[model samples]
Target chain A: MSKQAGLPVLEQDEAVCCAPMVREPLGEEAAAELSRMFKALSDPIRLRLLSLIASHEGGEACVCDLIGPFDVSQPTISHHLKVLREAGLVGSERRGTWVYYWVLPEALAKLSALLEIPAVSAKAPA
Target chain B: MSKQAGLPVLEQDEAVCCAPMVREPLGEEAAAELSRMFKALSDPIRLRLLSLIASHEGGEACVCDLIGPFDVSQPTISHHLKVLREAGLVGSERRGTWVYYWVLPEALAKLSALLEIPAVSAKAPA
Candidate 1:
C-alpha cells in the first residue's frame, strides 16, 4: 500500500523542517498541509483515542487493548484510529490479527513546537 | 456581552490546568472542550492569520494590517479572527476603526504543553 494511503506522505519531511507558527507567517501551502494534521485532532473521539494510544503501556497499544475502554463500537474506535494514523499523529502495524498503534513522537513534537510562544514575546505583557 | 459569545469561557480554566495528552487519557469532557479549540485551528486561513498576528510588530496586528496579506476579502479575515478569538488563541480589542488582535500566550502555552511528550516516553525507543 502507498504510504500516503495511511499518512501525510508529502508533508512529513516539511513537518520536520517547518518553523513555529509564531516565528513567521505560515505560507499558504504549509498552512494547508499543517491544518490537515490539526483537523484530525479537532475531533473529541480522535483526541481521546490518541491520548489512550500515547499513554498506553510502552507507548503503544493493540487494537484489542484500545477498544475496551471506550463505550463506542469496535469499528468506531478503529475509524478514529485510522484518522489519527492518517494525520501522522500515530503509526500502526499489523501483527497477526491485531494492529498495534503507537504515537508518532516527532509529529507531536512538531506540533508542540509550532505552538511554542517565543521567549521574548512570551515574557511581554499581555 | 457574555464571554462565551466571543471565547470559550467554560473551558479556559480547564485549558490552563489540563495534563499533557501523553501523560494520561483525557476525559470525555476535557477532550470535547479542547476539540473546539483545535477545530478553530483546523483551517489554513486561520492559521496564517494567527501567525501574522503573532509575528507582527509588537506581537499584535490590526484587522487592517491582517487583511492585506491574504487573497480573501476583509470580512473573511474578520471571520477567521473571530474564530481565533473564540478559541482563546487570541484576544481582540476595538481601537478606533480597527480591531487589534494579539496572541494569547497562555492559551498557546497550554496547547504546547498538552502536546508535550513525557520525558520518559520521549526517550523510549520507537
Candidate 2:
C-alpha cells in the first residue's frame, strides 16, 4: 500500500508551520509600550535631540549645550525633551546651571530590538 | 600639552573626539524621514498590524486576512495600512480581489539600526 512519497506541502495553508525567520509577533501590551516610545520619536526635533544626546561626549548633554545646534527656541527643545523623558526614552538631572539628559540605553535597546526583524529566508520551506 | 603629561582631558569640551561607541548623529533630512517612519508605528493598532504582516507566512498578508484579527472596522485597518505604506515601512500590491501587504525589510533595518545605541562605555576616554 506504501510507495515512495514526499511529505505533503501545505504551501497555501494558513496554519502551516512558521518559517525560521518569523517569530511570535508583538503582543498588545508590548505594542502599546513600544508605540509610546515610537510616538516620542515621531518628531524630527526629538529624534535629532535623542541622537545628539546619545552620540555626544559622555552620552549626556547639558541643556545649555543643545540649544545652539538648532534654530528652534529653548522652550521648544525643552518641550521635546519633556516628551522624550515622559516616554521613558531618556533621563534628566538638573545640575548647577542646566539640566543634563542622557539616552536611556534599555529603552533604546528595546526599541531597537523590536525593529530588528530577522531577514526573511530566500530558501522556501522544506 | 608640550610636557610628557597625559593628554589633556577635554572631558568637558564640546568639540572633543568622538567616542568609539558613538557615531555622527542623524542629519536633519534623515531625521525627518525616520521620524515619518516612527510616526507610522506610533499607534498600537498600526504597530501590531505591521508585526502581523511581517511575521506572517511568506512575509506578507492579504488585507482581507488582516481585518479579521482586530476589533476595528475594515476601514480603520485600511487607514492604518495606508499610513504604513506612505511611510515606506510596508509595500502593497493588488491581486485578484484583495490588496496584499508586506514589510519592507530595508526600512525596518534602517529604523532598527538608527535606534541601536552601542553600549555606552563605562570607561572614560583615553
Candidate 3:
C-alpha cells in the first residue's frame, strides 16, 4: 500500500483487524467489542469532539484548546473526551497544566474497515 | 473506480458523500446525521444482524432464514431489524408471507468514509 507523507506506519496487525461486514457474519464477541466503540460515537457532541481533536495541529489538541468552540461547558467537553478515551478512539496525556489528546488511528481504521461494503454486495439482485 | 462484478453502480453523489473526520470538525447537521446511524449500530444484536444480512445469499435474506441462528425471540429479532431499517442501513421488501432484507451499500459507504482517519493524522508527534 502507498503510504501517505508524514504519516506513521500502520501496525501490520491492525491493518487487517476487521473483515468487511458483508464478507461474513460477525461473531458475538467481535460484535460486542465493536458495538462499544459505536456506542461512544452515537452522540453528536462526541462525534464533533473526536473530529476536532483529530483535525487539530500535530494531530492532537489540548483540553483547553478544545473547549472554546462549543456552547457546552468545560466539564461536559471533558466528560465527552473521557468517553472517547474510554472507547479507545482517542488517547490523552497531561503536560504540566493541561492535557493533550490525539486520535488512535488503529481504532478508527478498524471501524472504517468493519463498515466497508464488499464490492460484491453492491450489486443489485439478479 | 473499477466496478465490481455483478454489483450495481454506486451513485456519483454517494461515492463522495462524506469527508474524513480528520479533515475537519463535522458540522452540527452532519454530526447529527452520522450519530443517528451510529446509534443504530450501538446494539450488539443489531450489528450482527446487519452483518448477517449483508453476507447472506444474493446479498439479502428472508426473515425465516434469519431467525434460526439466534436464541432471541422472533419478535426481538424483528424489532432489531426495524431499527436497522429505520436507520437506513438496510432496506426490506415484502413478497408473500416473508420479508427480505438487504444492506444499503451507500449508507454503509457513507459511514465507512466518515470514520476514515486521514493519512496526515497518522503521524507520531515529533
Docking class of 2: acceptable
Candidate number of the best TM-score: 3
Chain A TM-score, prediction 3: 0.83
What ranking of all candidate models by lDDT puts the best one first? 3, 1, 2
* Candidates ranked by TM-score: 3, 1, 2
lDDT of 3 by residue, A75-125 (tens): 999999999999999999999999999988878988998898767555435
Lowest summed-lDDT stretch of 10 residues in model 2 chain A? Answer: A12-21
Task: Give the distance in Å from residue B25's predicted Cα in candidate 2 to where it truly belongs.
Answer: 2.1
- Residue range B67-120, candidate 2, lDDT tens digits: 888899999999999999999888888989989888877566566666666555
Tell me the spans in candidate 1 whose CA falls farther than 4 Å from its real position: A1-17, A120-123, B1-17, B120-126
Top lDDT: which candidate number? 3
Cα deviation of B86, candidate 3, in Å: 1.1
Please write out the lDDT profile of model 2 over residues A26-122, one tens digit for every residue: 6676677778888999998898888788777877889887888899999999999999999998899998888999888767666766777565421
Q: Which stretches of candidate 3 lie over 4 Å from their true place?
A: A1-17, A120-126, B1-17
TM-score of each model, paired residue for residue: 0.83, 0.78, 0.85
Least accurate stretch of 10 residues (summed lDDT) in model 1 chain B? Answer: B8-17
Each model's lDDT: 0.81, 0.74, 0.84
For model 1, report the TM-score of its A chain.
0.80
